[model samples]
Target chain A: MTIKENIFENLRLELRRGCLTLAVLAQLRQEHYGYTLRKALAERGLEIDESTLYPLLRRLEAQGLLSSEWREEDKRNKRFYRLSGDGEGIFVQLLKEWRAINASIDNIL
Target chain B: MDLLDRYLQAVKKHLPWQRQDDIIAELKANLEAQLEDKEAALGHPLTAAEAEDWLKQLGHPIQVAARYQPQRSMIGPALFPFYLYVLKVAFLWATVIWTIVAVVQIAAQTPSELTVLAAVLRVPGMLMTTAAWVTLIFAIIEFVAARCPGKFPMLAPPAAHWTPGDLPPLGQQLSGGRKPRSFAHALTEVIFGFLFLVWWLLVPRHPYLLIGPGVLYWHASPFQLAPFSVLFYWWVVGVNVVQLAWRSADLIRGSWPRPRTAQTIVVSAIGLIPLGLLLSVPDHAYVLLRNPALDQARYSAALTSINLSIQWSAVILCAISVLELLWGIGRLSLDRYRKHAAAMR
Candidate 1:
C-alpha cells in the first residue's frame, strides 16, 4: 500500500477498535454462541470475523465482562457467551460516552 | 488424513499446550458447524474442493492459532518501549567496553596501521553482536513476564502505577535513538586536522603559504626535502587524515564517541613514531634555512642550538606519548579486572 493509505487504514482501525468492543458487549446482553454472534453482528452491519471475535470474547470473559460455558446442541459442543453484570454496567457507561461524542460530532459537522 | 482433521491438527500444534484440547474442541465444533452450513447452502454434502475452500477462508493455521494463544508476545506491546530502553543501555555499555579493549590492545605494542585498521573494522560487528544479545535477553525476559509477571519486580509493576518519578532521566538525545552520536570536541579536531593538512601539504611546495612574507627574512633559500624527512611528512599527513575522517564521522552523528580515552591515547601513541624518526636526523639538519642575513660561521652555530631545541621538544613529546599509552593500558586493564578486583576486596 502507499504510505498515505497505510496511515489511514491504521487510523481507521484505531477509531473502530473501541466501538467494536462496545458493540460486542451490547450484543452479548442476550446469550449467543461465537458463530451465531458473529452472524448477528454482521447482520446489524458490523461484520466481525471469527479470528477477531473469538479472541475478543475470550478477553472480555477474562476481564470479567463476559461469562461463557460450553453446552451440547445439535450433537456438538459449542461455547455460549453472554454479558456479565459488570459488562452491563460498563456497556451502559460506554453507550452514554459514545452518544455524547456522537452528539458533539453531529453539532460540529 | 481427513482434510478437516489434518487442518485442525496443524492449528492445534500452535495453541497453548495446557489449553490445546479445549480450544481445539471449540474450534472443531465451529469449523464442522461452518462446513455443515456451507453444504446446506449447496443442498449437498461437501466435496473435497468445497471443504478445502472453507478451511482456507478460516485463515492459515498459525494465524488462527496465534489469536487463541492469549495474545502474548516474547515482547508485548506494553513492555516494548522498556525492552528497547534496556537494549539501548546495553548497546552503550558494550560500545564503551569494546572500544577500550580495542585501544589497549592496539596501544600496548608497536603501533601499526593494520592493528588500528583491524580495531576499527571489528567495532561494527561487535556492536551488532551486542544488540543481538541484548534483544535475545529482553525477549526471554518478555516471555517470562508473559508467563509469570510477578517473578521479576521490574516487569511486575502495573501500568496504572507509573509516574514521572518512575521514568529515567533523559539521556543524550541524538539523531537516532539506537545510535548515531557526535561530539563537539571531536568535530573541532576534524576541522583543525583538515585545515592543518591543507597547510602542511601546501607549505613545502610554496613556503609562503603559512609564513607568507616571513620567508624573505634570513635571506631564505629552499633546501631539498630529505628522503627520511619525506617519510616523516607522509606519516604526519596520514595521522592527520585519520583524525579528519574519524572526528568528521563523530561530528556528523552529533554525539560523543565511546571510550573517549581511546581516541586521545591512540592519536598520541601513533604520533610518537614520526616524531622519533624526525629527531634521529643523521647529519647537519638545519640546512632548510640558509640564513644569509647572519655571518656564515655564527649561523651554523645558531642552527646547531635550534636543532638541539627541536630534539628536546621531540623528547618531551615522546615522553608524553609513552605516558599516554601507559595511562590508556592501565585504565583498560583495571576496567577488565574491576569485577574481579571488587570481589577480592
Candidate 2:
C-alpha cells in the first residue's frame, strides 16, 4: 500500500476501536472456546482480524475483565472464556450508552 | 503434524497463560473425540487437511477464547469524580449569578416607590430565563463531550453485557481502534487564555497614567476621575486572573497525576496577581495640570474609553465563562452516562 493510503487505513482502524469492545461484549454471553467466539463474531457481521483479537483477549483477561477455563473429555480438550462479574457490569453500561448515542444519531440523521 | 501444530499455536496465541494451557489440554482431548466421531461417521480415519479445515471453519482461536469473558461496559468507575466536579461548578456558577442579580434588583428599589410584590415576581422570571439559557447551553456541551475520545473509561454498563456464546474473546474485543482528542477542549483553553492575558494587561495603573502631552510640551494632565476607574480595572483584572488560573490548574490537574492541594494553591496564587495590583494602587491621585478642576468633556471621554474597555473585557470574559461552564457541564453528563453504562453491565 502507498504511505498515504496506509496512514488513512490506520486512521480508519482507530475510529472503529470503540465498536470492537461493544461487539465483543455482546457476543460473549455464552461460554464458547476461542475459535468458536471468532466465528460467532464473524457471523454477526463484525469481522475482527485474528492478530488483533488474540492479544486483546489476553489483556482483558489480565485486567480481571474476563474469566476462562479448559474442558477435557473423550481424549479431547478446548479452552473457554466467560464474562466475569465486573465485565458483566461494564458491558451493560456500555450497551446503554451505545443505544443512547445510536438513538441520538438516528434522530439527527 | 504440521496442521495440528499450527492450529494449536493459533489457539494458544489468543489464550491467557493459565487459560492457554487449559485450552490446549481441552482441545487435545476434544480433537481426539472429534477424530473418533469422524472415524465412526466416515467409516475411516480423517485426513489432516480435513481436520484443519474443520477447525478453521469454527473461527479464529482468539475469537473463541474471548467468548468466556464477561461483557465490559463502555463507561467505567474511573471517571466519576471528574464528572461530579464539573456538575458542581456549573450549578454553583449558575446559582450565584442569578442569585446576585435577584437580590440586587430587590435591594435597589424602594418599598414605598415600588410594590414588593412586583419586584418579587420579576425575580422568578429572571431566574427562569437564566436557568433556561444555562440548560440549553449545557445540553449542547454534553452532546459534544460524549464524542470526545479517551476522556472516559473503557468499560460501562448496557454496552458490556453480551451472551456467553456470542461474545468474542477478550483479545479479539480489544484488538481494534484508537480515539483522538476533541477540538472543543483545545479551543476553549486558547480563547480563555487570550482573554485572560488581555484583561490582565489593560488594567489601569494606580496613580493613573498621564494622558495627552507630558510637562515638556502641553501641560501633562494626570487625569484622575472617580475611584471607580481603579476599582473597575482591578475588578475586571481580578475576575480574569482568577478564571484564567482556575482553568489552567484544572487543565494541569486533569493531564498530570499531581497532588490536589498543590494544584489548588498554584491556581489561587495565579489569581492573586490582579487582587494585589488593585490593593497596591493609590485610590485617588492629584490631576497635576495648569487647571486643577476636572474637564467634564475630556473626563467623560477618558471615562468612556475606560468604560468601553471594561465593557468589552466583561463581554469577552462572560462569553468565555459561560462557554467554559457549559463545557464543564457537558463533561459531567458524559461521565454520568459512562458510569451508568458501566453499572448496567
Candidate 3:
C-alpha cells in the first residue's frame, strides 16, 4: 500500500477506537450475549469481529460497567451482559459529552 | 464440533492461566453461535475446510488470546521512563570508567596482548550483567507497584486528584526550554557514587580491584600508590561522600531547587583541588612495590611507566572536573538571572 493509504488507515482506526467503546456500551444497555451483541452491532453498520467484541465485553464487565451471568440459552451456556446502574449513569454523561463534541466537529466541518 | 473444540483448545493454550477456562468457555459459546448462524444461512453444516477458513479469519489463536489478556510488560509504562534513564546513566558511566581503566592498564604495566584481549573480551559480559540486574530491579519495583499500589504511593498516578493549580507557573514549566536536573539522574548518581566510594576505600587493601583480573598470575603484588596519592585518597573520599549525600537529598526531594543547585556548584568546585594535587605528583620517583617475579630493570621501567600513566590519568580527570564545575556554575548563574528577570517583569 502507499504511505498515504497506510496513514489514512491508521487515522481511521484511531477515530474508530473511541466510537467502538461508546457503541459497545450503548448496545449493552439491554441484555445480550457476545455473539448476538456482535451481530446487532454489525447490523447497525459497526461490523466488529468476535475477537474484538468478546474481549471488549469482558473488559467492560471487569470495569463494573457491565454485569454478566451464564444461563442456558438453546441448550448451551451463554454469558449474557447488560449495563449496570453505575454504567447507566456514566453512559448518560458520556453521551452528553459525545454529542457536544459531535456538534463542535460539525460546526468546524 | 471437533474442529471448534480444537480451535478453542488452541486459544486456551495461550490465555492467562487463571482465566483460561473461563475465557475458553465464553469463546467456545460465541464461536459455536457464529458457526450455527453461518450453517443456517448456507442451509448445511460447514465442512472442515470451511471451519478452518473461518477460524483463520478470526485470527491466530495467540493473537485472539492476547486481546483477551490485559497488556503487560516487565516494566509498565509508568516505570519504563525511569528504567530507561537508569540504563542510560549506567552505560554512560560504565563506558567512561572502562576507558579510564583500560588506559591505565596499558600505560602502567604494559600487559601482554593476550591479557589486554582477555580484559576487552570481558566487557560484553560485564555490560550484560549490569543490564540484567538493572532490569531485574525495575521489574521487581513494577511488580510491587502493581500488587500493592497504596504501599507504593510514589508510583500511584494523581490523575483524578490533580488540578490546574498543581501545574508549574507559566514560565517555570520544564516545557519552556529550561532543562533541569531530573530525579532519576540524581538517584542514579547517588547510587553509583556510593558504589564508587566503597570500591575506592577497598582499593588500598585489594589493589587488584583497580587492576584487571589478569594480575592474579603475578607471584607478588606489582603496584603501590604514590605517597601523594595516599594523601589525595582522603580528598577523593571526602568529595565523593559530600556528592553522594547531596545527590541522595536531591533524589528524595525529587527536584533541584536553587539552594541545592548552589550546593552542587560549590561541591564541584571543591572537587577540583584533589585533581590538582594528583597532577603535581613527581613522575619517575613515584615507585611501585617490587614484584619478585620480575627483574630489577623491568621493575624500574614499569614504575616509570606507571607513574607517567597516573599523571596522564590525573590530567584527564582534572580536565573533566574543571568542565563539570564550569557547567554547573554557568547553569546556576543562568537560572538565577532568569529568576531575577522574571521577578522584574
| iRMS, all models | 1.2, 7.3, 0.5
Compared with the true structure, all predictions reach lDDT values of 0.73, 0.55, 0.77
**lDDT, model 3:** 0.77
Give candidate 1 misplaced runs (Cα > 4 Å).
B82-90, B140-345
User: Which candidate should be chosen as best, given lDDT against the real structure?
Assistant: 3
Which residue pairs in candidate 1 have backbone atoms (N, alpha carbon, C) closer than 3 angstroms, thus clashing?
Answer: B181-B255, B182-B254, B182-B255, B182-B256, B183-B255
Instruction: Give per-residue lDDT, candidate 2, residue A89.
Output: 92
Give the per-residue lDDT digits (tens) of candidate 3, residues B90-175: 76566546645653464345344454566668779778888998899889888887889789776554443569998875333542
TM-score of chain A of each: 0.97, 0.83, 0.95
By lDDT, the better pick of 2 and 3 is: 3
User: B230, model 1: CA deviation in Å?
Assistant: 20
Fnat, one value per model: 0.56, 0.24, 0.88
Against the true structure, what is each candidate's TM-score? 0.61, 0.30, 0.61
